[model samples]
Target: MTQDNLWQLDAHDIARQTTSGDLRAQDSVGAAIDRMNAVNPDLNAVVVDLSDEAMARAQALDASRDAGTPCGPLHGVPVTIKINVDQKGQATSNGVVALKELIAPDDAPIVRNLQNAGAVVIGRTNTPEFSFRADTDNPLFGRTHNPWGRHISPGGSSGGAGSAVMAGIGALAHGNDIGGSLRFPAAANGAVTVKPGLGRVPAWNPSQSAERGLLAQSMSVQGLITRSARDLHHAMPTMIAPDPRDPFHVPMPWQGRALDGPIKVAFTKNTFGYDLHPEVEAALDTARDALVDAGYKVEDIEPPNVFDCGRDGYRALMGEVYSLMKTDVDAHGSQAIQDIFAVYFQEFPPFLETDLLQIMAKRSHYARQWSLFLEDYPLILTPFLPRPFFKPDRDTEGGEGVHEVLGCAVYSYAMNFLGLPAASVPSRLAHLPQGIQPINIQVVARRWREDMAVDACIAIEDRVGRMCRPLWEHMASS
Candidate 1:
């Protein structure tokens, strides 16, 4: 293999080579830094470059390796952290300009876990204002462009992470999702990611002044975006390492109990009354075929009421957001974000006060229904979005636009509401009239079965192939 583009290697290969003493930690970090410098000017994916610190850390890791110390699973791997998360001394701005000077005094749990596993933070990626929009742009860091071209929106609020990883700026990009942050970007950028189930991955930001709302705490999750599904498997194990900061975190092992026989998957092309794009339908079929070929017992069935679960769940979340975050957003957010939220309220209509209390109680109802459904099908294959990714600032176009961009994303956020693990992987690359882009399909696993979801992602990936090659080719030609 060519060593000229070491930055393109996945986290698995980087760890294998670095731990085996075949590749120097400094070399990997340097390659990633070089790549970031090359593409980030145009992409703006990495808002805060940490090349100096990353290089120093890489040298120290190399010295430790030379001195015969054992390496961590992610030893020498370069990664990016989302700007919304605390990373000690860096600003957890969450894309709000007014909070730009608010530096974190300590690292978030995900940051500690990544560093403990020897992952070097090359840079911090961008997010939308208050990290709420479906498209990544902020008055603080501007817009993060899709590496594929300007035709696509680099899905937010983890848009920067998705754009950076796929652009080869990092092997893995750390991002958190409340609704569809992780999956949105993965789908937009043609990357792979699994949004960990509630309690599966520890999460806590040391810079926070107060506790998040009950639903916010339950729905949000931290995860990584990568170029391949296998990379998620390699990195997520270390990411789930225990952190005492998050009291609700479940200290469960990454690998769960094996099933007795072929895993059954519930497949559906239901778009919840939205117009399901032909490309998305084809992508779902591709995933079904891939799963079937991989020995999964694929059945054409829909899991519970995803539409009701998604709608009520997001409405409930809007209530929590209105209660807990409305002030910060009103005070610090941009007009663009505020207007988008207006449309969001019109679309989902936040349930307030007592209604919020009742909806929060209803969460268990949705989760329980899905849990029973999973008793027969351990996995569910669905479309991440009813259509391909929308253009930049699409959500700002009012109700119809937000509806097209986010309203149709029932599968993306329903998992967050239910706190179930869902993996997003590209099943087909669509060549549209404007340009070529990848269409991602989602595989949601039973609660705490993130490993199974990732395994399913890998199986589909084995058939459809990784998306990075085509993306890189497009970049080169462009």
Candidate 2:
């Protein structure tokens, strides 16, 4: 591929060619940097550019290749790291001005893993204050616009990762998900990602002075966002590499044992009490049709109670936040974010004291039920959001806005609480009044079977096609 279009290729192809000496690492990284410079001004997706160091690393990689040094699996593939995670010398800013000087002394596990696999870091991406909002904006880095248009938000926490990857800034963008962080962005930007089960990918921030609460430790996960679902298959193995710093990390290989017979998938249109938009229903149908055509035995059946599971889990998480984080948030968070958190507390009232403990214990009960249900059906297909994604700063409109933005996301956070792997993939690209946007559906897999979820995402993608080509054309025309 020519330099102008090199940024369009996925990480797998880039890795294959670079590993075979058919492509130079410098060319790959330079193309990404050039693309970032061209498109990132409007998007604000990348907050910290590391072009100089990236090019230097590329030169060193090329020299090693010339000297016959062994290549890693992701040789020369350009990637972006989320600013909340550590990267040796870069700031783990988490989109807050207070943490802008919090330089990391060492690489976080995911960062070191990507380096070990020969991926080049092109830049660090943006996030909301404290990385808690469902849309990307911060006092430190400003707002990250969706590549599609200003009408829709670039879904947050990992909003930058989604927007950048889909906009062709990098083949892969690193992100983390606590609630619906990864999936939300993937849905908003028409990208693809699988939120790994608990302990699947080792994670820690070297700049942090205190440990996270129990629920935070249990629910949050590290993952990657990419234009094509298969890119996750190529890159996620390295992300799961064991690190001594994370004692709870599961030391497991990427692929799990093949299930016998046709894989069964439990499908549902249950939005609980929320009104399911026609566009969302259409997207779910498309995904279900694609899966059935791909030889999956898709069935109409409800799995576990995701609504209650998600509600209680989030309330319990809020309880922990209330106890441990309110003071810091009140002290350092922007007034906008502070106001959003106030509404958040109103929306999901924190389960206090013994109630928190009880709900935390009940998490295992939900996980067990899901585990048993997964025994019958290896995958569950559901709506990632009950409607199309909302506009930027919708969460700032108070309780009604927060409900619209996050309340309907039962299928998302429930997976995190249950510690089950889930993949988000676009099934439809719709041109709406605001702008053209994608509608994505979630595929929840059995625990530790992130591979299966991504496999289904690949299948759905094979039928519906990826959003990158259309998104690129749209950006060009705009």
CA shift of 182, model 2, Å: 0.5
Q: lDDT of each prediction vs. the true structure?
A: 0.93, 0.94
Model 1 score (lDDT)? 0.93
In Å, residue 223's CA in model 1 sits off its true spot by: 0.4
Candidate maximizing lDDT:
2
Per-model TM values vs. the true structure: 0.99, 0.99
- Return the clash pairs for model 2, or none: none
lDDT (tens digit, per residue) of candidate 1 on 1-478: 5666999999999999999999999999999999999999999999998999999999999999999999999999999999989999999899988889889999999999999999999999999998898898898889999999999999999999999999999899999999999999999999999999999889988888888899889999999999989988899999889999999999998899999999999999888788889999999999999999999999999789899999999999998888788887888888888888888889999999999889889989999999999999999998889888899888888888999988888888889999999999999999999888999999999998999999999999999999999999889988
Candidate 2 structure quality by residue, lDDT tens digits, 18-134: 989888999999999999999999999998999999999999999999999999999999999999999998888898888899999999999999999999999999999999988
Model 1, residue 350: distance off in Å is 0.6
